[model samples]
Target: MTYTHASPEHGAPERADDVDDVARILQPDGTRVSDPALDRWISDLPPHELRALHRDMVLTRRLDTEGVALQRQGQLALWAPCRGQEAVQVATAHALAAGDLVFPSYREHGVLLARGARPADFVLAWRGEEHSAYDHAALGVAPVQIIIGAQALHATGWAMGAQRDRSTDVAVAYFGDGATSQGDVNEAMVFASSFRAPVVFVCSNNQWAISEPVTVQARHPIAGRAPGFGIPSMRVDGNDALACLAAMRWALDHARRGEGPAFIEAVTYRLGPHTTSDDPTRYRDADEVERWSRRDPLARLEAYLRDAGVLDDSGLAEVARAADAFAAEVRAACIGAVTRDPASVFDHVYAEPHAPLERQRAEYVDYLDGFSR
Candidate 1:
């Protein structure tokens, strides 16, 4: 969603459709804006923690670039780039407690990393080396869901389970603006509302859903849809790391406190193609990309940190070096990944061995033996 400054000091939406109450704590120019309602959530963060957020964004971006490079090099089948949506991804992940769970779409690499997934775990699925790259149980994250907004239903169901168990854990569902139009997402919201499930719906409205613009699918702010489901919602400046963090913290807290499900529309932009197979240039204008580039989340956060004396030139250099090192490690890991046995594909089909699955697995192995013969 676009916005117009109400005054020289603050940004205010010119129309209700623009989400008149969108929360913004940092401007594109790196100036900090006071958000009375949301500020307290992140007020206790120290300079070091703030710096960590910057580091995570830089690292996540580096990982994304590496993924694209690997895919282009034919090392991986495909990759989803999360270039400009780092703030929303990283901040929302950080908002979760260790006990909380996440059901994320394919593009949430930042969230996976934040939740303790290894670099190898990020690429194994893309490489076709494994059905699932990470141990979801250990990470408290579900396997990456590629079927659009289906993860929303999974999250809502899990939240209902947690509610029944009387656990404080919140289930968070992360998807793009495109997913909002999906029936699964809408149904998930309805169920979550009816049961007062402890879930947070984070819709990263990154302008485009693949080649389709958000404007094409929805007439008003995506956040506005939540009210109809009896869910409290907020629209936030996804490019502003602090604002994203604050909004996520607020949503998670609300859910964790048994306040039912909450929704967040993070107004961000995708600065790259949807995936390795996508050609964004065909649909988006170069000038539009240039315009959003000025609102680069990483750059503005870096600027804010530097201005606040949290990170000087040396510190910034250190972060760059660290990100580079991490990316190199990830690259090496992806390139040298051990290929999984083909027959092992049948291994995780069910929790325990089933007669039909076992018979199929045996037949599959026999077929492989025939190939050898």
Candidate 2:
């Protein structure tokens, strides 16, 4: 249901700040713009950590590129490309602790990579061999949610439990710009605020949610919606990895400290088509794409690393080689994935063995056996 008017008790629809002026710590050219006194708190990450983030970003892109290729080659049913939002996903993902949980929207390839989801896990699922490539317990992440914004409620409920346990762990809900319009997301925020759930609503506002631009959905910034829920909200340049990492760290810290939920709207662009089947060129202008291309997160971070002398030409060469190798490995896995038996799809439909499900599984078995005969 579209929320035309929130309750008056929420207070005159709390005035929204100009989100275009939201705080940002990193420039497109890798220049720092954060407060001088809080330099260490913001961008003074350990050298090794920073280096690792860069590599992970590159690897994420390589996986994304290969995933698209696999889909085009008919190895996978469909693919959601995360081409332009790598920095947002990688930085926010790395900010979480090992025990924290993540509920990702379907296109969270970068987050899945940061959470240690291998190429095999992704390919096997896309190849229709399994329900998902990830094991929740091992990865500390839930299965990808395709039913838009449903995971927000899950995250909120999980965060309530975490809060009761008095644990520092937090629950993160990752969704796209379009999710804000979902009733599930709004209801989740309402419950989270009322109960002070320890969750962070991380919205990757990549400008376009499929064919609909963000402007078509909301009149104000998505972040502004949180204020009405009594949750602290902020916007970050999603293309700036450094800014995203710092913002996520701060938001996680707030939730971990029992300060209730936080909301982050990451401003980014989607460089590729929404999915393998969607054509973005029909609705989007070429000039807009070109403008955002100049702000490519990887190139920005690459410039920063080179400018700061953190990486030399040889180091850059190694990164390129590593990306290529990683892509090849993913391609091999996708091609080698085995098809799952059709009956297996019904194996876990009912936890306690519902009679109807059993009948269906049996019928499926009989159907497959007939094909063999």
Candidate 3:
């Protein structure tokens, strides 16, 4: 689905009134807000488009589940599950233009998938076979940054480039709430505001950074921090696909109109371990998981569709079949990816060859040859 550039006359100005309007539409109790503009926006979306969002959430959830299984089976070194956070990734990425660049944290497999990165490509990364599985220039996606908040710097730099070229394309940086404490993240905000860079800083505030709860990071809401950096910010119900889509649309529009960077804090839960290597049960309560399960993105969207008569039992069964088939394919690719060469570690180190690296590469090859004998 594509979004057109919204003119000032097309929608209400994003002020206190609009914020209140959006908050009403996204109330947690499923009450419908009375607004012609909001109703029209929701009603204008075709059933197929809504179903597509459902499919993306289902497929990405399945991918995260299978990835966990692969790690358990010793096929991957590690895996980060975006289990309950699918809406933040899928809806936000879907709201972007083809020309926009995405700076992803390592856990944003769903974003990569939405940006057209194949399942095999993502598998290769977790299999520890490649730092990045695709050409960033080709995909308009940066390599997944493992160092928390580092991608913010790269995203800000890319935004600067877009501004210099007078391009309308925006850049999006995906990071967790934990990254907010990082110096690089703060620096990126400074640069983005100072230059009024066309970018969106998307914080998937899943409420944890590994074992730490978000309360340890900030006493107030994380979105409130954006205004201090001279950027407008909003909080969206990350479990609600429609809310995420709307918030992302607003952020992207703000960027495209030369209004400078906007911040989106998607309030969601990470219903799984930080990674396959970590056991969340030790740190978090099972009751907490059960609670968030009630607010599951897939279930919420499915309920919305069923209520609207957009999806039925038979349709859900078909989606299940497709999800299963896709998961099987991903599993097969991930298993194969595990056996690939551990070489090529020296290939992309530098644009110009380094003498020390060359020597080390020769020695490594000789050591491997010795094993053959």
Candidate 4:
């Protein structure tokens, strides 16, 4: 079921149908807008809690910008910019409990940050020095998956394991709009629903999958696909920090209560290129970027904070200072990543080496020794 609100700008029906669409809490202009039911949820949250949410959004954006800068400086091989989707990562991650495990696609640096994953470890993989930087046991965050939708299966399987142990802890899988096209993601939804696993599937629908628009992935809204897999779903304004938090909290509550999996498709935009490699201007228009810029998540959240008296000019300045310091630390960490030893490549290939690999390793060592002489 969907709800339709008349467009405040045109006075015409903003949305013709609401079959799979969901209402948003914060409007593009920074007004505290929301559906009656969801409004109560946010209204009930403490003011201090709300301010923290805003802070996370600010820091996440800074980290994303610094990441892109690192890529340009040749500190990292590549970077995936989440320039416009800070709210989705921050709000959703804040909703999760410590017991929950999070499986993230490569772009979910914000989620990793919220999960207490060190920024230094998060960037090491991108710096081409390590495949995974954090110990999963310590952070409860799996290594960033580069194979797109594959992490969804890992999340679902983990949730199934938790169910067998009779644990109420849930699992959350983060993926992009483009990942919806992958078969493993579909299979994950199937298994989660069939076994009633406690999982939340978060689709950060940033409109563009690399250069391809979401239209190429789905004929209707992506949220509509949830019903087919027997999972309830909602679409929230990805740029609205408050709404994203409320929607995520709702989904997390449902999953932890043993209500099975839930899906959240955050309707947002990718304000930058797909990564450092691609130029968006070739396929998308500059005007489109300008249009989304007006709806900037950081600006909207600041407006709300000012209206609530939780943030003044001094508070804003402090946040900026904090962000600058954090960015500098990240830059330093990237520059100081340790170089791997030449023989380290074969160290972790096997706990008990097989005959074929042992033979290959011996030959490779001999070849390298010959070069040294």
Q: Of the candidates shown, which would achieve the greatest lDDT relative to the real structure?
A: 1
Taking the tens digit of each residue's C-alpha lDDT, what string does model 3 give over 1-373? 1111122354532321112222224344433444332243355568898888888888899889898999899988899999999988998888889999999998998888787777687788778777778888878899989999999999999999999999999999999989999999999999999999998999988888899888877766677678888898876678778877777887888899999999888888899899888988888898988978877878878877887799999999998898898889888877766554545688879999889999998888888889889
Better of 2 and 4 by lDDT: 2
lDDT agreement with native, every candidate: 0.88, 0.84, 0.81, 0.83
Task: Summing lDDT over every window of 10 consecutive residues in candidate 1, give the lowest-scoring window.
Answer: 1-10
1-373: candidate 4 lDDT, tens digit per residue = 2222333455664231222245587777788764865675566777777777877778888998999988998889999888889888988888888889999998887888777767687688888777788878787898789998999999999999999999989999999989999999999999999999999999998888898888776766787788889898877788888888888888888888998999988888889889899999999998988888987888888888899788889988888888788888888889988888655667778888798887887888888899879
TM-score of each: 0.94, 0.92, 0.89, 0.92
Instruction: Put down candidate 1 lDDT per residue, 1-373, tens digits, no spaces.
Output: 2122242245432332253257899889899989887789998989988988888899999999999999999999999999999999998888789999999999999999888888789888999998888999999999899999999999999999999999999999999999999999999999999999999999999888898888789866788789889899888888888988998888888888888999988988899999989999999899999989999999999888888989999888898898899888888888999987777898878899889998998898899899779
Task: Count clashing residue pairs per candidate.
Answer: 0, 0, 0, 1
Checking candidate 1 for backbone clashes, the offending pairs are none
Off by over 4 Å in 4: 1-21, 350-360, 369-373
For model 4, state the Cα shift of residue 248 in Å.
0.8
Q: Compute the lDDT for candidate 4.
A: 0.83
Model 2 C-alpha lDDT per residue in residues 30-130, reported as the tens digit of each score: 77676432244455687778888998899989898999999999999998999989999999999989999999998999998899987787778777878
> Would you give me the overall lDDT of model 1?
0.88
lDDT of 1 at 2: 19
Sort the predicted structures by TM-score, highest score first. 1, 2, 4, 3
